[model samples]
Target: MAPPTTGRLSALLRRCASAGALSPGAQLHAQALVAWRLPDVTLETDLVLFYCRCGALPHARQVFDTMTPSPSMHAYNVLLAASPPSAALGLLSRLLAAGLRPDRYAIPAALRACAELRDALLGAALHGFAVRLGLFSNVVVSGALLGMYAKAEVLDDAVRVFDEMPEKDTVVWNCMVTGYARAGRAKDALDLFWKAQVEAVNMVRDVRAVPSVLNICAKEGELMKGREIHGRMVRILAFDRDVAVGNALVDMYAKCGRVDGARAVFAGMKERNVVSWSTLISCYGVHGRGQEALRVYKEMVSQGVKPNCVTFTSILSSCSHSGLVTDGQRIFESMSKVYSVEPAADHYACMVDLMGRAGAIEEAVGFIRKMPMEPSASVWGALLSACAMHNNVDVGEIAAYRLFELEEGNASNYVTLCGIYDAAGRSDDVAGLRSRMRELGMVKTPGCSWVDVKGRACAFYQGSVPRYLRRRIVWVLDRLLEDMGGSESEDGHTNIYYDYELIRP
Candidate 1:
């Protein structure tokens, strides 16, 4: 006889799922099976659910597939939802071949799998199915639909689903906000956030806001608007003391060139996370203060705040900008052993940059080869740049070849290779690369830099004559470059001294 149903199994399942204890859940599932005899469909379904919730989709499928051939719609749904896009697609195709009709609950989860796989073609067919069954109006179904369109970058379709909704909730609002922000429609995202605020106040009496909304404002770089939102949070005490809100504020201020404001906010925070440390470090790195970034990193370490991948990336960027190659190598070496954090692609790219900027072209190339994963175009691009810096024409050629293979659509690779050839006085190679670029209809863009004077920002483009500049500025630069030209040039190469004069003046 089946053992009487009890809270023990249910509670254990919930705990294992919540904690991502997949192996333990499987063991408990085995125990539950032995604890009962002639287990009913409900118990089998519960077991399937345990594996699904634990993200052990393969195990879920094993249990679900072996169950009686006459599977419940819920069983099919679990399989469809638990599997990834490729797995889900194969399962759905098999289910159709078996002549089983999909239930309403199963369809949305399947659609979500399509979205995850970015299989927009399959997602479109699922949309039609939902519409034909009049299930498109279901709130959960509609939200999943919106997610699909958003992932596919089909803003119009997503907006249509959002518009057709009879009611909207914070989750729906968040989804749209995230979509617009990711699509680079920052202003539109900010507008939607405002609308969500008004809707919250009027329709939902118990509606509470989340810090993720503040993150949207930060992403848009509307500093003034973000400040106003922060003010609102303070007035209503809506996440005023939340760690995430504080972190968002710090990140916003730092990215907006108000690092002092960021520092002030960081000082006031009740608790600090690795993100908070990374944000400030990135600010210092961007401002060309590698030493200050390192100092802050030290303070974080002393306070027992572990440096995450982002924090290390920021510091690596600082090292690259300030030419701290040795320090960068130390951090890179310590990352895996000291912190036990596995290096991601970005970390590898930073290391390449560090070695490249320090004129360690060979070391950088070797690092790329030793990388466990395939080196991306950015990684090769960094090595290419380093080769150019050290005038390693042979290595530059190889790096350029790899980069071209990786990203044929981007024309920057050819241009960079041509410039390196020209710089090294390889006239024949330079001419050949230039002709190829012309054939491909690619043009090299001039380098440009911007500097803020008082409150205004001004740009200077390479090879472009400056106009309306103070006569004193032009006179000083003319003399400085002329003096440096005689002193700094070797053969035909010219190395100017504008960097020093600009700082001193």
Candidate 2:
């Protein structure tokens, strides 16, 4: 047989790497070494990439070090992309010492490494270096810097980098909006998004930014803004066609207490994936519409869209929340037998919650014992909560003990156990639990609630309102009470009640 050419060798190596055939890749690397007299830079770089892709970083480093004179920026980038943050930073230092000027690719990869490490100092230094080299003007580099600052939770630095950029591209705008959204600065994110829409007329808008904005709107209950974006998506025809955008729209509507809107979007989508079905199911779950959630799941399976782990989780959660014990049990069993999807720890947690909520505490404990893996804290927590509800101090104590061992720092577990003890009139147990909590320095987290008003999120603690919004808040509450046919007492006290009924179509 004729000896293989570099092209043939390269193709074979890529195939091996793509298939994750590490042994074959190694053998091919050996063959290439004997076939090539002088090292080919492209072939060597390909080999480095292959090794990196296969997770053989040491072998990749060896190949990199033995390259004829030295590796190129491309070679360094492959290593950087594959290595952890620490290793990638070390590679950046080595690249600098080797007198190789970092290019667009190398800098972004290094910045990503810094972001992963959450090393703001290193990332800022790189930003300075890029500025000195005049590469900060490059849109890709600027976006990288913005992303690094965002990931480090340094929003001020991100805003500064964004504002000082000579030109803003769609990617930079998207990064900034996403950063604000992630930092819980919803108003700022919406402002930047609207500004981008208005000011960047000549530039093509990024469709990717819509999902981040929708998520922020959903989290803050900014339904009106979410609707505006949905309208924009419809105008651009992305609402019907883009599955990801469709999923986000459904999620936003669902989380904003608008299950009907979520169903409308779900029904309108021309393309649907597992996420779409999962989102819809979860929406129904949140609204306590277990039967509707199951109907959607059936429709999803009937349409031949195979369920993934997340789909099962949503459906299982629905069953648990709505007390569909039999359905939960059947689904849990079917996961492994019918779908070949083994139950993960979360699935087990859901099953435990389902049984516990149905007043089957002993059955729930037995189910935990049969779990393929050890039960998680969430599983025990569910049992403890169920015990509290049923006043089963015996099982509650068992669950609490297991939970304390697993989640020593969780104050809620201690509180829940104390509540169970107090309800059962076990004063000594309550005192001991309280003493332990004090000794361990565990304090209960403050209770808080938030409402979106006029495009801004207002947070209230316990029973206190913000001083600036006191009058407005009181007026709104009184108006709502009057509309519900409730009047204030002679002492000027009004009572409020809440119910969990789902909004029917």
Candidate 3:
């Protein structure tokens, strides 16, 4: 049989690559070699792309290196995109050495590789190269550069890139806003979002920006801002039906301690995906509504939605928090046997937590021994926490020893061990642990909580408040307590007040 024409073969290779048929792509490559002693550059490039798409980097390199004349910039870009960040940088260097000028396409691909690798130096060098080549202003290249800087957590550089860009397209704006959110500069992200709104940029048109801000609100516990964004989404008649947006909204509300709001969003969604289901189950789990979480999981399975690893993790977490040991164990086994989902370390950690929480100390230790892989810090931490809760000093010490070896710098592990010793009346051991911690210069991280008031977030730290604001804050709190019929204990700590109207004051 005669091989197809070059054009026909190129089309076939594209289809195989798109379909991710590695074996078929390799067979096609062999057939092309047999058909043409010296295939055209286009065919050769196509073969490289096919191999790259199939993750056959070695074959891609072979095709690239064996080309009679050096490959085109397009070929280099394809290889760069296929390679890891370091390899991509190496390819860019080779392109420069070969006297091939990188065009708009090649520069952005290399920048993206740098971003993923978080190599700030390499990314900055690529930015310089793009500027020298006069390709920096290209919309795509500028967007990639901004994203690279953002991923590297060089927010100032990202802002500079944004400010210098001659044209600010929606993609550019989205990148900057998302970057600020990811860097925990939530105010900056919200400011930019409102700025975009004032400029009438139709932010809802950029589907990516909404989720980024929603995530920021979630992290900062800014429920007011989150609801405002949700209202905007509804007004625009946008993202109400988008599964990703819906999932984000649900997560935001859940993280803010508003399970009812999250549940409302979940219930109102016209369509739901695995993420939507998982987020809702996670919400219930976190709020200690384990039975409700398990119910949702069953409903998801009944609706034919396939649960992924995250879904299992959430459900297992629910079981652990709810003290449903038997249920957790059943689900853990079913993950591999019934669902064919291999239990990752997280799943094992959850299982250990479940056993520990249920006071099965010996079983939990035995479970760790039976794991296919080495137990991680989380696994040991779970055991240690259980020991503290149950006053099991022996097991607690063992878990603490493993934890100290695993996470030497985590002061919380040492603190937890000290607490266990104190509870067991082992003052000597507790003092020794504290002395060791002090010698090692370890300090416990301060506990902090955040509340959103009138669209602003206020973070409060344990045992500390700014002296300047202390008087005014105390006066306001006194008024709030008076209004709520609250009384102070002998130690001057306020007793619980069920009325939430105190928040309004």
**Tens digits of lDDT, candidate 1, 140-213:** 88888888888888888889989998777667777887787767776677788778878743422222333445
Clashing pairs in 3: none
lDDT of 1 at 50: 80
Q: Which has the higher TM-score value, candidate number 1 or candidate number 3?
A: 3
What TM-score does each of the candidates earn? 0.72, 0.80, 0.82
For model 2, how does the per-residue alpha-carbon lDDT over 1-505 read when each residue is reduced to its tens digit? 7778888888888888788888988888888877762387878888998898899999999889888788888899889888888989999999999998888878888999999889999999999889888899888898899999998999999999999998887788888888999899988999999999987753233587788999998887889999999998998878988888899999999988877799999999999999999999999997788989999999999999989999999999999999999998888889989999998889988888888889999999899898879888988988999998888999998999999899889999999989999999999999999999999999998667677676556875653544556656556655776786475545343434442111111
For lDDT, the strongest prediction is 3
Which numbered prediction scores highest in TM-score against the true structure? 3
- Candidate 3: residue 388 Cα off by (Å): 1.7
lDDT of each: 0.76, 0.87, 0.87
Show model 3 residue runs off by greater than 4 Å: 1-63, 77-87, 200-202, 453-457, 465-505
Residue-level lDDT tens digits of model 3 in 6-110: 888889999998998999888878788788735588888888999999889999999999976778777898898888878888898899899888889888888
Residue runs of model 1 more than 4 Å from their true location after superposition: 1-39, 50-63, 66-69, 77-83, 86-103, 201-221, 236-244, 341-352, 355-380, 383-410, 413-433, 445-505
Ten-residue region with minimum lDDT total, candidate 3? 496-505
* TM-score-better candidate, 1 vs 2: 2
